[model samples]
Target: MKIKLKIWRQRDSRSKGEFKEYHLDDVSKDMSFLEMLDTLNIKLIKQGDLPVEFDHDCREGICGQCGVMINGIAHGPLKNTTTCQLHMRSFNDGDTIHVEPFKAAAFPIVRDLKVNRSAFDNIISSGGYVSVDTGQAPEANSIPVTFEEAESAFDAAACIGCGACVASCKNSSAALFTSAKISHLARLPQGDKETSTRVVNMVNQMEEEGFGYCTNTEACQVECPENISVLNIARMNYEYNKAKVLAKK
Candidate 1:
């Protein structure tokens, strides 16, 4: 297969960027998107041209490090598919593919398709953890978490913090990401101790990072690679409200 790629090329965050077109020929339909990029980069290197910069790690789609806008869709046209998991078969021969970074105020372009997603790390640093004491591992039966609660927590914990939710939102909100962090812990018994404080602090940090407010458009949930539900946002709001009300008492 062959495709024409119109990729965004930026020298750096300070440099002006624009689309540069390149033709990729004889691409295997079985090759993953990132693998196709590798092929392109190899050709660029042989020609003494600067290669397109993108992020990828654990290309099996577990790390969530591989993410970008393909034809204006986060991770490409496939639902619940990360860029690393996207294959060339999704596109036809002679297709003109538009590649760009995940656009958001908090995720400024660093170079080409690479954006600085450290804003998410900052939010997690604020309060996305448990403050448990250091000790030997506890027995599994000691906590007695219900099956339903464990499943719910697992679902929320599945979020990889890829920022797809932010990229997909018209307002560039991080509600789904922030809420998943809140919900994962809120459902677990060990997380109950800091649930109230965690929600408040995380939300505050999310806003401070320049992410827009959630308007319940549900676009974030739709584009999330993990399929994280918007329900987590509601859960976070409820927790925040409850925390605020209790603090008043």
Candidate 2:
């Protein structure tokens, strides 16, 4: 396929960014989106040009690190698909593809098609895990959790912290990402002990990281590769409110 790319290029966070145009005539229909990028980079390198830098690890769509805005959509036009899993076949022969890094105040541009998402790590560090001492592995049936509860927690745990939620939100909200981390543990026995404190700390940390408030637009879930529910945001609100009430005592 012959594809025209209008890609954002920036040397660093402080540098000015703008779209640069390039044409690719050799993109294969079977090539993954990242593979197409590799072909482009190879052509650029042969001409001694700086190749576009984008993040990718375990390009099988499991790592969630290969996200990019494609044609104004997060991770391309397909529902619940990551960029690395996208194929050139999705586009027509003469399509103009606009590729850019995930944009948000919290996700500062590192270079062409690369953004720093460490704010997510800061939110997780605040209280996303079970800190209690369990000492050793317990029996499988010891917790007595119902199957429904386990499934719900597992669904929430499916979030991969890709920051697509933030990038897709009009307000640049991290609510979906933060809430998934909160809801997963809040539903589990091992994490219940610190639920109140965990919710409080993590929510606070999310705000500190400058993420905008969620207004129920639900754009986050629409672009989320994991299809993590916005209901997790409701669960997080419940936990946060419960935590605030408990702290008054």
Candidate 3:
């Protein structure tokens, strides 16, 4: 299969960027999207051209490092899948694939498909942790958490912080990401102590990062690779309100 790629090329964050077109021929349908790019980069290198720069730590979709807009959709056209898990067979021959980095003011382009997502790190640092004492590992049955609660917390915990939610939102909101982090802790017993302060601080940090507001568009939930729900946003709102009310007293 063959496809034309119109990829965004930026020398650096300070340099001006534009889309550059390249033709990829004889691409195998079974090849992962990143693998196809590897082939393209190899071709470019042999011709003494600079290779396309993208992030990919674990290509198995767990790391969430390999994310970008493919044909205008975050992590390609597929639902709940990252770029690394995307296969070339999803597209047809003669297709013109538009590849660009995850776009948002909070996530500025560092180079060709790579963006600085340190904003997420800052948000996490604000309060995404449990202040438990260091001790021997507790027995699994000691906590006695219900199965439903554990599963729900696991679902929220599945978020890999890829920033797809922000990329897919028209307003570039980080609500989904924030909600996932909030909900993951809110559901767990161990996370209850810091829940109130955690939600307040994290949401405040998210706003400080320059991400736009959530208008309930639901786009973030649809594009999230972890299938994180917008309900998490609602949960965060509730937590935030509760925290404010309690603090006022």
User: How many clashing pairs per prediction, in order?
Assistant: 0, 0, 0
lDDT of 3 by residue, 177-225 (tens): 9889899999988997799999999999999999999999999888889
Q: How good is model 3 by TM-score?
A: 0.98
lDDT of each: 0.93, 0.92, 0.94
Give the per-residue lDDT of model 2 (tens digit) for 120-188: 999999999988657787778877999999999999999988888898999999999999988999888
What does candidate 1 score on TM?
0.98
The true-versus-predicted C-alpha distance at residue 129 of model 2, in Å, is: 0.2
Question: Which is better, 1 or 2, measured by TM-score?
Answer: 1
Backbone clashes in model 1, listed as residue pairs: none
Candidate 1 residue runs with Cα over 4 Å from true position: none
Evaluation by lDDT, superior candidate among 1 and 3: 3
lDDT of 1 at 240: 94
Q: Which ten residues in a row have the lowest lDDT in candidate 2?
A: 131-140
Give the TM-scores of the predictions, in the order they appear: 0.98, 0.97, 0.98
- What number of backbone clashes does candidate 1 have, counting pairs of residues 3 or more apart or in separate chains? 0
